[model samples]
Target chain A: MKMFPFVRGNKGNLVGCPVPNAGYSMTINIGCARRSLHGRYFGRGFDSHRLHQFSKGGDDSLTDKVDETISKENPTLDQIRTVKKSMSGAISDSVLKVSKLAIKDGFQVYEAIINLVKDVAMKSARIYMVFKRIEEDGNQIIFSEPSVVDIEKENFDKTVKLFIITKKSTSEIESTISNISEIESVSVEKFTAEGYQTEIPAVASILPPNSPVIKVLLVKIGDQTYAIAISNIERLISLDSQNVKTIEKIEIASVEEEIIPLLDMRDYFGNVKISNARQNAVIVEHESVKCGLVVDDFIKKDEVTVKTLGKIFKNAKEFCGGAILQDDSIALMMDIPYLVEKFSQVLKINVNIGQQHDI
Target chain B: MTFKITHEPFDVLTFKLGEKEYAIDVGITEMILGKCKIFKVPNSPDFLKGIVNLRGEIIPVFDLKSMINLEDRENSCSNVIIVKIDADKTGFLVDEVTEIMSIRSEFTTMKIVSANYIKGAIIKQNRLISFLDLQDLLVGKMSAFELGGKVG
Candidate 1:
């Protein structure tokens, strides 16, 4: 019986296996296999009420090992230029820089790069409580939205591994297992490596089926789940000597609709335009300019009126206006002109994100 | 209220989907490649046409025609204009090679959507062109290759 061949290791999760019409699916429940997440996060001695200051995201242990795995390969600029030609001008220079740095540092940062994650911000402490079954989704089910019960952050970074799951519905729970991303390691039950019937010890986990085509690898961060989609799963894998714990359980959360993907883009070309820019960001409109500047993000909207904060940013590169937000955080209103001039020397225009293929 | 391009001329690199014309600011137009090999990825977002290898890097391309609720036309014109517009590394596939137009100033170019994030539309070739409205194009879509953001 060549089932999807992959099955969650824990027996409890196996109870939820092979959902109706869902072929090649199996769930296993390893109860509290790594449920010390609260102590790993909240137990940290640092005390801070802020998000960014406390936002040193992820228990970066195993990932650190993974990052270190590719340390020996010293990728060169010339190699990148050659790859770009193969990439047919899709890889942005910013992304290439990161790729080079990753190759130099022996890690891959360009993959699974989650940013601006506000919904699950510093409120990780609250999520910690949910891990203890103190909270549940709107349904009164006890294990509803099942969270990690005992996983900690340190154990995550030190010992966690990864695996792949494929073909899951949007925003729908992949498995009965709660929080699939937080588990440390897994076994390849029904996977084919290099077109061979081979099973590798998976360092990550995916939702199954959907990830098969894109080649996504799901990894655990503290007690959260994130997907790493790419073409070459091998180029993305990093080897670590540290032994992380096997996954106990995952809450299997789905990427929601209307969820905004965060950009790693900083200020581009200091020119701004004052149009619908009031929403996410403002565009600086100059009378003689051909292309205006685009602010990376919107800190605020509809405060007072459309006016600059009397700040002259002629020499300043990215920002022009300095307006205080309602939260009292001073946002440097971006200057598009200066930014463009600053980056004018850069090899502009390349797609740095995901899915690489050869045509 | 009227605004003129006298402030500045923003060059919008426009493209055609089937026979209709659409445009986005050239700033967001990352790569305008002509006719690459595209592979069909199962269970992707409906708008996503398939994946392509520029060289070794694989990029997911979206069909602008299919995105606008238009019917799929077989073998009309298969020129994929891969636009890496946002953080998602998404590609928008347009049909045929149309010239890039620099839009002069006009405030009425923006078309209004009925209660959606679509802010406005632009007029091209005398026809009311509904621009990609990138903000709206991305609003409800989930991330790539993830569950719910992927195909079941």
Candidate 2:
């Protein structure tokens, strides 16, 4: 119970005072050591021994002050309590001062900078380790594969979030943000018209040898493509949609970067006439003739070449025979003659002509 | 050269179909007749006046007034003509037979309206009488007629 004299400073703070003839470090110069620690506090390691001295008031100056009082030969209990109280306050004040000075000294500013290193010295075997664990909780996402290029941050509606990438971008990282709605993580951002052209990128095919492609009609509408397959081609004579919208089409001879549907033909060209009266169109002398069991819409008058469409009805694809269009997107020519003949039969109309008509 | 010029007496049979008045060539007159009921044919041409039986002959009667784009788009019929066709000959009914007259060759006139469709005129007592070329008018043009069409 060695005690310090209760000496209140003008600021009303309890500070310890040295006993007579017991002052130490008049030769060792411990304050100069504390000055060096200001830089050490921010360095790679902390000087734990010196730090402990600061925390425990192990400074020879503080010891000399206590030793001088101990020579008083076990002072009264009241005197012991006063010394303990005053010593604790002085220690705290010194720690805060070093922390502030450590800030200006270009080292890491820390509370208990020296004391912390001494306490955790066993954990790191590093008495010079300066960083102290204030408070921490285990959290944060653990990614499986860090080599997956990078995950992206994006926004939709109003919420900002992250998006993962599986492929390289031909466009900007932000552009991939437009596709964020397609990802499963964000269902609320789902785009109604799914599977856009940006996703199903087109590959260049320069294969000259023609492969037997099971043909279906692909209709190019705006940027979207539609596929239609006709088995009983005769059943449709006319399906008219007065929904007329005029599109400004560049009348070039070739199709450059045109996106066509997987297996369908454009509705623009549908019915083809066979007979002479139908050179311009299928002219029916019998006026009342209309749709019955076969022959419906007036598909365009064009010839689709001979290529047997294989067992592709499973895809439920739509197309006529493959007739190359003015543009290379390929037109599957429709058999309006066959369709008309079949349906004309069910409608009780005769389409079988004995004479050949010249165009 | 036995050439004697004289005005031949021809009747200008006038009649009304809805509102307009018209007269056909009387020198080519076969018969001027009135309403003799008719039979309807399905899917017939718009101007097909109907088929009529006259003197045991099934004559196809056409209302020239309506057929010639005069008062068409109407349901009323008043008159018809019974012309002895070099092809099909039978007397047909018309509206009303007015009178007969004699006109000089100078009064006789003709003209073509549209290059394809025909239109002609004759002066009768200060009134202009139009004679429509039925055959040419029958060959009407629809939008399907495009350039590079096989005219043959």
Q: For residues A1-359, could you state the per-residue lDDT of candidate 1 as single tens digits? A: 11121112121111111222322122212222211111121111111101001112232442343234324254322222233222221222222222233335432221111111234422323333322221122100111111111122111212211111222221222121134334222222321211211111111110111111222233222122112222211122111212211221111111222111111122122123323322221222223322222222322123311112211111122322232223332233333333333232121101100101110
List DockQ for all candidates: 0.01, 0.00
In the order shown, the chain A TM-scores of the predictions are 0.16, 0.16
Give me the candidate number with maximum lDDT.
1
lDDT for each residue of candidate 2 in B110-145, tens digit (9 for 90 to 100): 444333333444565676654444434433421112
Q: Cα deviation in Å at residue B141, candidate 2? A: 9.6
Backbone clashes (count) for model 2 = 37
**On residues A1-359, what C-alpha lDDT tens digit does candidate 2 reach at each position?**
11122111111121112112222111221112221111232121111111111122345554454445435543432233244333431222222332334334433321111111122212211110111111001111001011011111111122212111112222322333233322222211211111211110000011111222223333333223222234222222221222111222211111133211111122222323222221111222112332221122233433222221211111111222233332332333233333333233322111101110110
Alpha-carbon TM-score of each model against the true structure: 0.34, 0.26
For each candidate, how many residue pairs have backbone atoms clashing (under 3 Å)?
A: 86, 37
Our model 1 lands, by Cα RMSD against the true structure, at 25.2
